[model samples]
Target: MDYQNSLAFAQEQDRQDPLHHFRERFYFPQVNKQDAIYFCGNSLGLQPKSAQMYIDNEMYKWANLAVEGHFKGEEPWVTYHELLAGGAARVVGAKESEVVIMNQLTVNLHLMLVSFYRPQGKRFKIMVEGGAFPSDQYALETQTKFHGYNPDEAIIEIFPREGEHTLRTEDILQSIQEHGEELALVMMGGINYYTGQVFDMEAITKAGHEVGALVGFDLAHAAGNVLLRLHDWDVDFAVWCTYKYLNSGPGGTSGVFVHERFGKDPSVLRFAGWWGHNAKERFLMEKGFKPMEGAPGWQVSNGQILPMAVHRASLELFDQAGMENLRQKSERLTGYLEYLIDAVPVGKDVIEMITPRDPQARGCQLSLLVKRNARQLFDKLMESGIIVDYREPNVIRVAPTPLYNSYEEVYRFSEILHECLEGC
Candidate 1:
C-alpha cells in the first residue's frame, strides 16, 4: 500500500486492487478521447454508465405511455421514489422505512427543521457547527427568524479554538454540555464541506439526546464517501444530495432519513403532500391526509422521475459493489494521496493538511491550505489535465475516489503540484 514516490509501486497497487474493475462502471469525463485523472469527485462524481440506460427506459415509458405511465408502466412512475429507499438505507446505515428519497438537500433540511426545531421558551436555541456550508447557515438563520427569534441569540455557532482549522471532539462535547439546557436542536454536516473533518456522530447524538434536543446532519460530503450508522448512532434525522460521491449527476435528486421512532408521531409536523399520504388511500383522494407510517411520510410530491432514475441507476451499481468494498479501497487510495502530498517538497510552511490524519476521521478528501495562489496552482493542474477543486482564498481539495482514481493518479498529481510550486 506504500507507493512511496514509486510509480511502479503505484501501478502494482492498481494491478492488485480488487475494486479496480469498478472504475469501468463509470463514464470518466474526458477531453480529446482520453480519460482525465478526475480527483474532484468530492465536488461532483462521474456519471455511472447505467444512468443512461435507466433514464432512457423512463424516457421511453413517458413518451409512449403518457399519463398511463404513473399507474401502468413497468416501473410505475407513481411509486418511483420507493425504488430508491433500499439502496439509500444501505448507504446511510438506516432501516428501509427510515430512509426516503425526496426533495433536494436544502429543502429537506428545512422540512426536517420544521419537525425537529421546535424552539420553546428558554430552550429556543439551535446549535450548528461554525463554517457550515452557506446554504445550511442560511437555512438555520432563516428558520430561527421564522420562529420569531433573533438569529444572533438563538443560533449558537460552535467553532474550533483560534488557529485550529477543525473542531476538537472534546470541544464539541463540551459545547453541547454548556448549551444543552437552552438548545432545541443540534444540526451539523456529517463531514465538513471544507476541512473534510468527519465529526464524532455517536458523541454528538448522545449529547444532544441527553439534553432532550434532536440531532441531525447534512450528509452531502459524507453520503457515499464514508460509512454511517444513523440508526445505531441515534440520529434523529439527516439530509443529503446525490451529486457528490453518489455519482447521480449534477444537482440530482436528494434523500432524507427520519428515525423509525418518529415515523408514527403525529406531532412530528411534516410538510405533507399527496405522495406522503398512505399509498392505499392515495387513489381514494381522501379529504384528510393520513401519512404513510415511515420516512416516506415526509414526501411532498412524487419525485421527478428523470433525476430519481439516474440516482437509482447509480445506487444499483453501489448495491452490487457493496459499501464495505468501496470503503476498503477508499482508505488505501486516500492514504496514498496523503503520502504523495507529503512526499513532495512543497515547503512545510507553504502547505498544510487541514484534514484529520486519522483514517477514520476523514473520507477521501484532503484539503490543502496553500500559502500562495491556490487558484493559480489549481488552474495549472486543470490545463495539464489533472483536475482538482479550489475553494475560495487558498485551499485545494483533492479527492482520489476509490471507485475510479488510481494510486498512480495521486503520484502524478503530486509531481504536477511540485512542478507548479517550482515556477512560483
Candidate 2:
C-alpha cells in the first residue's frame, strides 16, 4: 500500500476501513471540547461505551441478590471469571481450559513462577531480557533470593548488542544456547515495553525446552497488541493485563495461560486458595486441596465482579471484531503513522525512531527518540488535544490503536508535530 501524507488520503483510508465502526464503541477523552486523538492505548485504552452498563448490571445484582448473587444472578458471580476464559483463550491462542482470568499481572507472574521456576542443584539460573518491566525484575530478584541463590549469580539478563535498540532474534537464540545447561527457566516479556519490540515467543519456547528448561512470558504489552499462540508455541505459562489493548478499565483483572500439560496436572506446586478447589466438592469444605482441572486451579481468590464486568464488556467487542481483523488494520494504521512522520522535513534529523522498521517486530507503538525540545513538543501536542505519552529522558511513545484511533488523527498529529518542530 502506497501511503500518502495528505489529509485526503488519511480520510480515504478511514472510509475504506472495515473496522471503522469500532471507534464508536469507545468514549474518548475531551480535548479542546472535542474528542482527543488518543494514541495512548499502549498505556491505557479508552473506556468502552458499554462499560458503565456492564458495571451497573453487576451493581444491580449485588443490590438485589446480596450473597445469593454468587449463584442466582445473571452470569453468577461464583463462576464469573469463567465467562472470560473462551475469549481470553482466543486472544492468547490457548485452549479454554488453559486460560483463566485472575489477579493483576505481576501477581499472576509470581503465581506462575511458583509452579514453573523450580531450580534444582546446578541448574538454577533464570534467563531474562535486560530491561524487563520493573515488576518482573523485582519478582525475579526476590524469587532467586527466596531459593537461597544470589540474584547477581542466578539471574542472566540478555542486553541488546552495542548501540542497537532492540534484541536480534539470532542473538536471543544464541544466548539461550549458551546458557542451556544452567538455565532452570527462560522468562521474558512477549514484547519489550519501552521499545515496543515483539519477541519471538515460539522460538524462545523451543530453545528453552530443548535445554530442559521451563518457559514463560509476561504478555502485558503483547497480549492484545500482537498475535500469540501460547499453546501451539508450547509456552509453559503466560500472564497479561487487559487494560492496554484489551480496553478494560484501569488496573483491570489479568488473564493467565498454562499449557495443557501443566493445566491437567494436579501435583504442580501453587499457592492455592478455596476458589481453586474443585467446584463440586467446594461446598463440603473438606480438608484435602483437590485442585480444579485447569488454569482456573491457579486462582487464589473468587472473582471481583465489577472489574470482570468491565472486562467482559470489552472482550465482547473483541469477539465481534476478531483479533485477525484488528491486526490487519493495526499494521496499516501504524504504517501510515510511520509514513507521515517520515514525510515531515525535520523528522529524520530531529527525532529517531527506535522501534524496528519491520511490522512483524512491533505493534502499534512508535517510540521516537526526540533530539530537541522533547518535553515542550510533547506538551504542545497535549495542549492541542493530541494524546500521546512521553517517557523519561527524551522518548515520546505514540500508539495509533486500530480499534478506536483514526488515520486522520495520525495525519493531524504529524502536522502538529511538524509545526512544533519548525517553531522550536
Candidate 3:
C-alpha cells in the first residue's frame, strides 16, 4: 500500500473502508468546541454513542425492579456480565468457557497468581519485562513478597540490549531457557505499555512450558488492540482491562482468560469467593465451595452492573465489526501515522520512533521518542487541538484507532504536527 500524504488520498481511503460507518457511532471530545483529532484510544477510547442508552436501561431496572431486578427485565442484573463473555472471547481469540468477564485487571492478576504462581522449592523465580506498567510491577512484587521471597532475588527482569528500544524474541526465549529449573512462572504484558511493542505470546508460552513454568500475561495494552490467539498459544492464564481499547468507560470492568486445564480442574487452588460457587447451589449458601465449571469459577463478586453495561455496549460494536477486520484497518491506519512521522524533516534528530516498524509486532500505537523540545512540541500539539498524550521525560504516545479514527484525521494530524515542529 503506497500511502500519499494528502487529504484527498485519505478521504478516498475512508470512503472505501468497510468499517467507516463505525466512526459515526462514537462521540469525540471537544477541542475548542470542535471535534478534535482524537488519537488517545490507546490510553482511553472515545465513548460510544449507545453507552448512555445502555446505562439508562440498567438504571431503570435498578430504580423500578429493585430487589427483583436480578431475575427480572430484558437483561437481568444477576446474569448481565455473562452477556459480554462471548464478545470478550472473540476479542482475545479464546473459547467461551476459557474467558470470564470479572474483576479489575490487577485484582484478577492477584486471583490468578494465587492459583498459578505456586513457587516450589528449587523452581521459585518469576520472569518479567524490565519496565512493565507500575500496576503489574507492583502486583508481581507483592505476590512474591507475600510468598516470603525477596523480589530482587525471586524476579528476573528481561531488558532490551543497549541502544535498543524494543525487545528481541530470541533474547526473551533464551532468558527463559537460561533460568530453566529456577523459573517458576513467566508473567509479562502482552504488549509493552510504553514502547507499544507486541510480545510474541505464543513463542513465549511454549518456551516457558518447555522450562517447566506456568505463563500468564497482563493484556491491558493488547486485548482489543492486537490480534491474540491465547487458547491456541496454550497460555495458562491472562488478564486485561476494558477501559482502554475495549472502550467501556473509565475504570471499567476487566476480563480474565483461564485455559480449560486449570479452569475446569477444581483441584487447582484459588482464593474462594461466594460468586465463584456453582450457580445451581448459589442460593443454598452452603459451607463447602463448589466452584463452577470453568473461568467463571474465579469470580470474586457479582457483576459491576453499570460498568459492565458500558462494556456490553462497546463489545456489541466489536462483535459487529470483528477483530480480524479491526486489525486489518489498524495496521494500515497506524502505518499511515508512522509513514507521515518518518517523513518529518530532521527525522531522528527531532524524534525517534520506539515502536516496532513491523505491523505484526505492534498495534495502533506509535510511541515517539521526542529528542528536541519535547514538552514544547507536545504542548503545541495539544494547543492545536490534536488530542495526543505525553508521557514523563520524552515520549508522546499517539494512536489512531481503526473503529473510529479516520485517515483524513491522520493526514490533518500530520499537518498539525509539522506546524508544532516548526515552533519547536
Candidate 4:
C-alpha cells in the first residue's frame, strides 16, 4: 500500500478507520493547553474515560457493603480477580483457566522462574537475549545466584552480529540448538523493549523444548500490542503488565499464563497462599494446602479490587475493539509511521529506524536511533506537545497505538519531527 505524505490523506484514513472512535474514549494529556499527540503508549497507556466510574463502583461497594463486599456485591471481592481472566486470556490467546491476573510483571517472572527454572546436574545454564530490559537481567542474575551458580557462567547472553540492531530468527534458533545440552531454561522478551523487535516465540519455544529446556517469555511489550498465542505456541509460562498497550492505569495489575499442563498438576512446586487453596474449603481453615484446579492455584493472596476495577474498565474497551481488529489497524498505523519517518531523509547517520521493517516482526512502536542530540530532539517533541519517550544512550521510541491514535496525528507528528530535526 502506497502512503502519501499529506494531511488530507491522513484525514481520509482516519475517516475510514473502524477503531478511530476509540481515541475519544481516552483523555489525552494536555500540552500547551491542548491535547498532545501521544505516541507513548508503549511506556504507559492513556487512562480510559470510564476508569473513574469503575473506581467509583468499587468505592461505593466498599462504603456500603464493607466486609460483606467480599461475597455480596455484583462482583464479589473474593472472586474479583476471576472477572479479569477471560479478558486477559483473550488478549494473550490462552485458555481462561490458564490465565491469572495478579502481581506485577517482575514479581510474576520470579514466581514463574521458581516453578520453571530447575537447573539440575550438568544442565545449569540459562539463555537470554543480550541487553534485555534491566528487570529481566536482574531477575535472571539473582535466580542463578540463589541457585549457587556464577551468573557469568550460568547465563548465556546472545547478541546480534556486530552491526545489526535486531536478532535474526535463524541465528537465535541455531544458538538454541548449539547450547541445547547445557540449557536449563530459555528466557527472553517477546518484544525487545529497546529495539521494538518481536522475536519468533513459537520457533524459539519449539527449539528450547527440543533441547530438554523449559521456555518462558516476558511479554510486557507484547500483550495487547501484538498477536500472541501462548497456549498454541506451547509456552510454558509468560507474564505481562497491563499499563502499556493494555491501557490500564500506571503500575497496574499484571497477568500470568501457565500452560494447562502445569496448572493441572497439584504436585507442582509453587509459593502458594490461602487464596490458592480450594474455594469450597477456603473457610474451613484447613491445615493442608489443597490447590485449586488451574492458574488460580498459584495465587499468593486474595483479589485486589481497586486496581482491578480500573483494569476492568480498560478490559471492557478491549472486549469492544477485539484484538484481531486492533492488530489489523496497528499494522497500517505503525507502517505509516515508518514510511513517514523514512521519507524524512534525516540522513542515515543522523536518524534511522532500528525497529524491524517487517510489520509482522514489530508491534505499533518504531524506535528511532538518533546519532546527534537524541535527548534534545526528544525534549523538542515534548515541548511541541508530541508525547514520545526516550531511552538511554540514543533511542527515541514512538508508538501510534491503534485504539487511541489517529492517522492525522501520525502525519502531524512527522511534520513536527521534521521541524524539530532542523535545530538538532
Candidate 5:
C-alpha cells in the first residue's frame, strides 16, 4: 500500500481492484469533461448513471398508466420502498423484516426516539456524545422538553478526557456506569461526524441494556463507510441517510432498523400514519390504525418514489460490490491517504489529524485540525481542485471513498495539501 507519486502505481491498483468496474457506473463531477478528484462523499455522493433512468422509468410508468401504475407497471410504485429492504438489511446487518426505507435522517431519529426513549421515574436521562450534530442536539433537546423534562437535567453529554482529542471506550463505559441508574436511553452517532471516530456499538449496547435502557445509533456517517451488525450487536434501533458513502445523491431518502426483539411488542409507542397500516387491509377504509409489526410501523407518510429511486440505484451497487469488500479496500485506501499526509515534513506542524490511528476506530474520513489561517489553507486546496469539506471552527474533512476514490486521488490530495501548507 505504499503510495508513490506515479500514474502506473495507481493504474496497477485500478487494474487489480475487483470493484474497479464500479467507477463507470457513477457520473463523476467534471472540469472540461474530465472527472475531478471526488473525495467529498462524506457530504454528498456522486450520482449513479442509472439514477436518471430509474426515475425516468417511474415517470414514464406514471405518465402512461396514471394511477394504475401503482399496481400495474414493472416494479410497481405501490411497494417501491420494499425493493430497498434486502439491500438495506444486508448493508446494516439486520433481518429483512427489521429494516425499512422511509423518511429523512432527523425525521426518522425523532420517530425512533418516540418509540425507544420512554423514560420512567428517575430513569429519564438520555446519554449522547459531546459535539454531536446540531440537528441531533436540537432533536434531543426538543424530545426531552416534549416529555416535560428539562434538557439540562435529563440529557447527559460525554466528552473526551483532558489532552485527548477523542472519547476513549473506558471513559464512555465509566460514564454509563455513573448514570446507569437514571439512564433511559443511550443514543449516539455510530461514528463521530467531526472527529471521524467510530464508537464501540456492541459494548455500548451491552452496557446500556445492562442498565435497563434502550440503545440506538445515528449511522449517518458509519452506515456505508463501516461494517455494521445492528441486530447481532443488539442495538434497539438505528437510522441513517444514504447521501454519504451510500451514494444515493443529495438529500436522499433515509432508512431505519429495529431489532427483532421489538417485532411483536405492542407496548412501544409510535406516531403512526396510513402508510404504516397493514397493507392487506389498507384500502378497507378502516377507522383504527393497525401498524406493521417491525420497523415499518414507524413510517408517518407515504413513500416518494423519486428520492427512493435514487436510493434503489445506490443499493444495487452496494449489493453488487458487497460492504465487506468495500471495507477491505477502504482501510488500505484511507491508510495510504493517512500515510502520505503524515509523510509531509511540515504536515504535522500546520495540520493535525483528529481521526484515530486504528482503522477500526474510523471510516474513510480524516479530519484535519488546522492551527492558523485555516480558511486560507482550505481555500488553496479547493482552488487546486481538491474537493474536501471544511467544518466551522478549524477542521477540514477529506474522505477517500472506496467505491470511487483511487489511491492516486489520495496521493494527489496529499501533495496539494502539502503545497497549500508550504505557501501558508
Candidate 6:
C-alpha cells in the first residue's frame, strides 16, 4: 500500500477505515482543554468510555450483594474472571481453557517460571534477550539465585550483533541451538519493548523444543498489538499486561497462557490458592489442593473485580472490532506514520527509526533515535497536545494505536515534530 504524507491522504484513509468508530469509544487525555493526539498506547492505552459503567456495575453488586456478590450478583464475582478468559484468549491466540486472567505480568512470569524453568543437573541455563524489560531481568536474576545458581553463569543473554538495533530471527535460533544442551528455558518478550521488534515466536518455540528446553513469552507488548498464536506456536507459557494495547486501566489484571499440555498437569509446580481449587468443592473448605482443570489452576488468589470489570469493558470492544481487523488498520496506520516521518525534512535528517521497517516485524510502535534535542522535542510534542513518550538517552517512542489513533493525527504529529526540530 503506497502511503502519502499529506493530510488529505490521511483523512481519506481515516474516512475509509472500518475501525474509525472505535476512536469515539475511548476518552483521550486533555491537554490545553483539547483531546490530545495520544500515541502512547504502547505505554498505557486510552481508557474506554464504558470502563466507568463496567466498574459501576461491579460496585453496585458489591454494595447490594455484599458477600453474596460471590455467587448472587447478576454476573457473579466468583466467575467474573472466567467471563474474561474467552476475550483474553482471543487477544493472545489461545483456547479459552488455555488462558486465565490473573495476577500482574511479572508475578505470572515468576509463576510460569516456577513450573517451566526447572533446571536439572547440567541443563540449568536460561536464555533470554539482552536489555529485556527490567522486571524480566530481575525475575530471571532472582529466580536463578533462588535456585542456587549464579545468575552470571546460569543466564545467557542473546544480544543483537554490533551496531544492530534488533535481534535477527536467525541469530536468535542459532543462539538457542548453541546452548541447546544446557538450556533449561527460553524466555523472551514476544516483542522487544524498546525496538518494537516482534520476535518470531513460532520459530523460537520450535528451536527451544528441539533443544529440549521449555519456551515462554512475556507478551506485554504483543498481546493486543500483534497477531499471536501461543497455542499453535506451541509456546509452553506466556503472560501479558492488559493496560497497554488492551486498554485496561493502569496496573490492570494480567492474562496468562499455559499450553494445554501443562494446563492440568499434576506434577507442574505452581503457587496454589483457594480460587484455583476445584469450584465444585471449593466451598467445602477441603484440606486437599485439588487443582482446577486448566489455566485457572495457576491462580494464586481470587480475582480483583474492579480491574477485571474495566478489562472486560475494553475486551468487549476488542471482541467487536476483532484482532484481524485491528491488525489491518494498525499496519496502515503505522505505515502512514512511518511514511510521514520519512517525508518530513526534519524527521529524515534528525530522527532515526530503530523499529523494523516490515509491518510483520513490528506493531504500532516506532522508536525514533532522535539526533538532537530529544527531550526538548518530546516536551514540544507534549506542549502541543501530541501525547507520546521519551525513553532515556535519545529515543522517542510513538505508537499510533488502531483502536483510537487517527492517521490525520499522525500527519499532524509529523508537522509538529518538524516545527519543533526547525525551532531547535
Q: Global lDDT for candidate 5? A: 0.90
CA lDDT, every model vs. true structure: 0.89, 0.92, 0.93, 0.94, 0.90, 0.92
Mark the regions of model 4 whose C-alpha exceeds 4 Å error after superposition: none
**Tens digits of per-residue lDDT for model 3, 327-417:** 9999999999998887778554788899999999999999999997899989888988999999889999999999999999999998888
**Residue range 248-274, candidate 1, lDDT tens digits:** 888888999999999877567878899
The C-alpha stretches of model 3 lying farther than 4 A from their native spots are 346-348
Tell me each candidate's TM-score. Answer: 0.98, 0.99, 0.99, 0.99, 0.97, 0.99
Better of 4 and 6 by lDDT: 4
List, residue by residue over 364-414, the lDDT tens digit for candidate 4.
999999999999999999999999999989999999999999999999999
Off by over 4 Å in 5: 1-8
**Model 4: lDDT to the true structure:** 0.94
lDDT per residue as tens, model 5, 151-254: 99999999998888899999998899889999999999999999999999999999999988899999999999999999999999999999998888788899
Residue 28, candidate 2: Cα error in Å is: 0.5
Candidate 2, poorest ten consecutive residues by summed lDDT: 339-348
C-alpha lDDT (0 to 100) for residue 268 of candidate 3: 90
lDDT of 2 by residue, 208-270 (tens): 999999999999998888888888999999999999999999999999998989979999999
lDDT of 6 by residue, 1-424 (tens): 9888778998998899989999999998899999899999999998999999999998898888899999894699889998999999999999999999988999999988888899999999999999899999999999999999999999999999999999999999999999999999999999999999999999999999999999999999999998888899999999999999999989999999999998868668887889989989988997988889889999889998999999999999999999999999999889988887888886677889999999999999999999988999889889999988988889999999999888899999989988888887
Q: Which ten residues in a row have the lowest lDDT in candidate 3?
A: 340-349
lDDT of 1: 0.89
